[model samples]
Target: MSNKTILITGCSSGIGRVTAKYFQTKGWNVVATVRSNPEAQTELNTLENVLVTGLDVTNENSVSTAISEAIERFGRIDVLLNNAGYGSYGVLEATPEQVIRKQFDVNVIGTLLVTRNVLPYMRRQKSGLIINISSMGGKISFPLGSLYHGSKFAVEGMSEALSFELETIGAGVKIIEPGMINTNFAETVGAAFNVDPTQTEYVAFVSKVMEGLETANSNHSEPILVAETIYEAATDGKRQLRYIAGADAEKIIAARKQLNDDDYMMLIKQNMGL
Candidate 1:
């Protein structure tokens, strides 16, 4: 049994929920948070060494209160998993400004806010780990995912820089890039497509990309894989910076590294039949 505590954001479903349970079973104190929901309370409260709470990562008060509560319950936070986010896919020309802002708000800004609140605790302890859940899209882009990719790209860059700064304080940062998992995240991405019918110029391209996305979703990895990866990252005790979780993510990111910019762009276009 371990006394270490891990605070995870977005525990209502998918990766967040699975990770919370995984950590609890490993005998670590777990703070599992969701965006204020009654059902979430009942669903997660059954676990031992788990504290389920309401936390809207984009809201400062919510982030502050949840961290405080976790500290109060566990006395110390050993890890912080920034997992609260959504996919925002749309053609840039057709995407509304407000939607763009909201995309950054939830994915990028929310991540930053939570990390900022938790850093003081880790800094004082002089030892801690921060694991951010980025996506393969952060490393490689796809058409109609400008907003989603943009935010993830920001996360990758930010995590890399923060790793350097945090090392000075005896803290470390790591990023997890999952390709595609069996979750409602794909459905949410489909629903978030913002192309307007009147914008006929992008229709054919969007349709093809959507088709490619559907085909890719047909072979997604299980959420447990990601949960397991998080556990490994937390326990590996190495100063590793990134862990690509899914098979698809590993292939894609590896390819991206091997190819030059233009070749990679062509490869993506060819794969999508664009």
Candidate 2:
């Protein structure tokens, strides 16, 4: 990994932050992006091989500028990690159009914009990796998370298509599907929905579901696990389109493959105490 340039988004916290540090420790030239985090910047700036920048994935200008700056600094981008996304927990009926659009903007369109900016450089080099951080939610939907699930599902579909498109081109595309990891993700998501009081009809149910997510996240795998998975996907010789990071993600993917939609919903409802 030494001397290789890897650019990662959403590096202020959670899996992205960990992955950036991990790659730097392995001697990679890391361009770590954050929306806003003074502490993260201060820490990463102290590192010899890291260049931390402010990046809002939903903004085309910000994404383009970040990628361009990274290229200018590092000469080329060897790996592009699309890990910037937030979860919006709400029933489809209760979720507003704005909320849905925001979710898609960050998760789906943001990924596309960043990838588009970075691909030309990769094509010129004729060797690069594009890794998208999806979730078990990408494959299986759960109650009170329709908007979030929808965004990840888009990621899953887009990644598959992009994998086929990039295969013959020398570049590669991979999806990292991780289940509930011990991070501030759930709290952040809960906060997103909590502020929207207009969806009062499903408040009770949504609250219960959010509680369950908090509990599940407590015993979840560490962010380092996902970081390691990203590293493998970026550097591994074999071309694997999807890599399930945690045991829970593997189980969920298996269940999604085996069960019918109705059966899966029944199981999800039962788990959520719905």
Overall local distance difference test of candidate 1: 0.92
Q: lDDT values of the candidates?
A: 0.92, 0.86
lDDT score for residue 141 of model 2: 78
Q: lDDT of model 1 at residue 268?
A: 86
TM-score of each: 0.98, 0.93
Worst 10 residues of 1 by lDDT: 35-44
Q: How far is candidate 1 from the true structure (C-alpha RMSD, Å)?
A: 1.0
Candidate 1 lDDT by residue in tens digits, 67-137: 99999999999999999998888788888899999899989999999999999999999999999999998
How much is the lDDT of residue 139 in candidate 1?
98
Candidate 1: Cα lDDT at 156: 97
Tens digits of per-residue lDDT, candidate 2, 1-274, equal 3799999999888999899999999999999999876355778889887888878888889888888889889899999999999888866775678888888999999999999988888888888999999998899877777788889999999989988778766999999999889888877876677335686777788777877776667668999999999988877877778999999888888988999988988887888788
